[model samples]
Target chain A: MPIHEKSLIRPENIIRHESMNLQGVDVSGDWSTFIGSRTITDYNEDMQDEIAALPGGEYIHRCWQCGSCTNTCTVNAIEARFNPRYWIYLIRIGLEEELLRDKDILWQCVSCNKCTYTCPRDVVPEGVMKATAHWLELKGHTPDSPSTIFDREFSNQIFATGKVEEGRVLRRFFASTGQALRQPWLESMVIGLVSRLPVKMLLRLGLSAVLRPKTRKWSKSRAAITDYLQQQGRAERRALHLSAGEGTHV
Target chain B: MTHKEPTGDYNGFGPGWKATGLTPAEARRATDWVEAKIDRRALLVNKDRVEDIRERMWELEKDGEIVVHRIGDQHEPVVARTLYGWEKKIPTNSLWHHKSCGQCGNIPGYPSSILWLMNKFGIRYLDETDQTSCTAWNYHGSGIGNVVSLAAIFLRNFHQAYVSAQAQGLPVGTYYPLVHCGTSFGNYKEMRIYLMHSAELREQVRKILGKLGRLVDGKLLIPEEIVHYSEWLHVMRHRIREHQVVDCGNLRATIHPACHVYKMVPEDVIYDDTVMDGNRVAVSTGLMQTLGAQVIDYSTWYDCCGFGFRHIIGEREFTRSFAIDRKIKVAVDEARSDVMIGHDTGCITTLDKNQWIGRAVDKVYELPVMADCQFAALACGAHPYKLAQLHWHASPFETLLEKLGIDWQQAKAEFESYLKDVADGRFETLYDPKRAITSGPGFVRQQGDQAA
Candidate 1:
């Protein structure tokens, strides 16, 4: 039987003969086309277990390959290569090589939860995507994505002050991510906002930046959260078989 | 039955299979099962298979494992049905406002509009400074924060909401929380399920809550219902419509249902038969319809605003591209939408702020975006600049204001003078400024304060 979905078969895997003859009958070009068979040997047998150890990846075992996640994915709508269903299949089968092929785009999962809403098997594919992205960063298969950097900056502010000042988050994120704060669109957006000259809003933004809005009496909560996250970080590292100090850059 | 000739062509199948000798309506009726198979309503009908966390929460509370914050008569509870036909009590009065950090920081108008609406209805509420963000955006964007931390924050905020009214000589449960962010609403619901299902998570969170003095009766506090402010607007649409001073009948509006609000823990979201045939998640649409606006349907109504948590801050090009191409462009070209209304902070920010960037790529779809509460407030004659704060929005809302017959020039002038007044330390507030600080260092007990 022929491969019905030709897109699944890579171009290099298709072998077509330009000139051939079989038993005095011409069997050339399209007639003699063949699919190249390749064996995958670099399978990490513990890939599924390692992913399931993460918070969002807990339900990866429940996926029944329904493809609803990919079909309803917000990112997959624009970027065809960001397929959650395909990645989930690769992870389940321990096909690490194939999974790494699309590692860079994994962090682009928007967490829209459309897939989780549509999943009949309660797979929560959105969480699996997050876990896989985290796994990639932790295992050093990929660098920390901009998304991860932004998350760290945002989360750190909340953990510290018990509230996030948006201006602080944006400035810290952009600075940490090594991006300029003066993008054309950003400048235009600020100009547009300033054109109206809502002085109270401007003063509020300045005041919040200077005297960052915080949850009052947040010292106890901050201390508790910091301790809890440290404990979780150690546990996650243990699950991934990384050293206690490994993957601490995040 | 009258037989009609087949109009469309079919290939590969035999002529016998090509034509069913049935009318188009009959064919549609015959294949209605296919539509029903994909319908969200039908999918939710199998609710028995999916666990209702509220039942387990009640069980846990009964077993002394947790304390459920009940919505009492003081809250003026109005019961609404969820997607699975489950009952959810939405408190319309004596509410504790859970403000979104993003809204307060970015779109100040979003929460201000909500508060303005509540004030219009003379609803008793507390807009205090005690609550923290749900912190789910960072979790979703970066995956650094775990469920344990999220659950702790969830309980901590609810505990504060539970006890916030005591500063004003009221009992502990006088105020029920009305979450103002879609992200928090969804995250709290998911966290509630996690806390209920896993005793270990509850125990872990309870310890943190105890340390912060946030526990109620030495147990973690959980809200009876994680209610969104839009849900409050939805249930009060009839009464809100009664106060409509501006004619919004001529405006065509499109609602971008926040994914977190509807898609995450979808069973808890409100669905009304009167709104879009109960097909869409019916908060923004319901309010818009009740305000006498033409709620137009667009193709990409189901798409995310492309805030993407991280995408907005890190990879904003993707956010702008998706917001313009998938959402704004379609709404303008297809639906001819005058304004696009959304409920979530991120969605409004993404859709509103990103429109200006489209000019860089020549995709200039200039659709104004604002929250449903902002639109509702506008319909009720709230000042666009003073209350709704439309000037902060990056989108072209001036056209929308003109179309609504609102005088932007006069409003801008009035807002400019108001800003001068603000500069001189004289300003108007929706509620008393002293009520904002319920506890901590800056809090000074009012004359009516009583021990709880």
Candidate 2:
């Protein structure tokens, strides 16, 4: 696994001073890029097993230290902190505290599958990233990411109505996220679209908002899907030893 | 001798279509058996159980019972360049248009260009109302969706397409689904493999489908192969030139292959360089090359469009930063591309909307972003504003359209005239962004739009 020249150390982890005398030795300046010592005693030995129980985390044991996932990761290319291989390693070694340090940014995985595509060992690091994210929320290491909130909102709409209206989803996501619907960029986008969109087309889009498009006689299908979803939620929670319908705060 | 004269002729096809392998009932029984012995939790955790299920899936696929597609040995670029010569997977004439949520909402022209091109080519297609958003957006962005629920929705949508084709007197296998969104294209393909691989999942999905009355003749209607619409365009590049209304000989296109389409399904993402004069890119770039456009490659060509769907609507900073820093800057500095063409709606939206914000930071990368179909439509002589919907895009497209010989001034005037007739809500959208700027970065509120 050829790790790139880019070091995995975060700025916060770097311990430095303008000038320092470490035990009477001048161990400061450019040569003294000392990393802070990490104290880790809180280890969840079952962390890997718990994540493995979740959908995407099953292939964790297969990773043979291949850094291919991070090398090819789309998100990793931009935000170097979002490394799949490093996170997978942390999960495997049961470094729960260390893993938690990166939890907030973990859910940013775009599901690109480059990790899965590049993994020679079939570790499917993409799935592991997803499972780890799900794992964090279930074990109460982190609160639900905005990604999850958006997912829940969008899924609920689909379960209720057979399909989603884009306008409805966008507006509902903004509202639920407690953000202003009048985002400057978003407004500029809508304004430009409204200016040119044929009146008939605009009306059609507006009308869908009023009478949301749905599959005819879809109640049975919706009921079936919703029922399965609830069962899954409970089972996943049960795997992590949490009560159904409960988060850490709750 | 008389007994030999009467030969048996029971060709298995049509209304009583029994391809092979386990029937729906038998598959259900096998599922019940698996659940009784080992629950799905074990399957998710235990590699032995996972392997056990994959064996059964292989059996079904081998016997031609449950037709599923594997990327085989090829990546998307290879498949795109090679498959058109023989692979029956990429359907040209008849297709089922699976609508995209983002494209239909934000870039209306995406779907319009696709439909417009299909009609121009006399390609018979079905755009049934029953086909829904792949729901992958919800799944990936929020993690609200589980495998079972997503599978059920996938089956429900594709069943609608299948039934629609049946009612139209077309053969069962005539119209393969041409997915509009990269997310749906990738998600459905994954779901197909999942369902085939696990009998437990198959059984669960079967019960759900049965409860919903979506089972096609009491059997799961799995297509032999799933393909993205871009593949269709790439396969039909030869025919597209025959119907080309405008010559785009001088234009240069740099493609932004949607990650969801290729990166997720790397092997299945068509890969054929020879098809485009040795240029290795997705269908968009290949299609452009066929229309006499020079398709260029640049660094960060494989980058995500920064939609991070949830991030775009919720965490704006990440989307903005990634677009300018990783995607657009490379496209401009390295490729020096005339236009940045993308296939997926999320990609197009991210690229099209964020370029202006990039300029605010004094970024030099401001290529006009558009969906591949919109680009194709423009090359085929479609109007920039009316057909291609360039007016909706934030990127500067007047120069690009002019280079292609489109009357940008007349189109802008038409757009302006329509802008004058808007009563309230639409007109109200234009004012606040400037107001936000004047108010500075912190809690800028408009007259009615209060900052939350």
| TM, every model | 0.60, 0.51
Candidate with top lDDT is 1
Per-candidate clashes come to 0, 13
- DockQ for each model: 0.01, 0.01
State the displacement of the C-alpha of residue B253, model 2, in Å, after optimal TM-score superposition: 1.7
Q: Which runs of model 2 end up more than 4 angstroms from their true locations?
A: A1-250, B1-88, B166-174, B275-279, B414-452
lDDT (tens digit, per residue) of candidate 1 on A85-123: 999999998999889889989999989999999999998
How does each model score on lDDT?
Answer: 0.86, 0.72
Model 1 misplaced regions, further than 4 Å: A1-250, B1-44
lDDT per residue (tens digit) for residues A60-109 in model 2: 99888869999999999999999888888888888888888888999999
In candidate 1, which residue pairs clash?
Answer: none
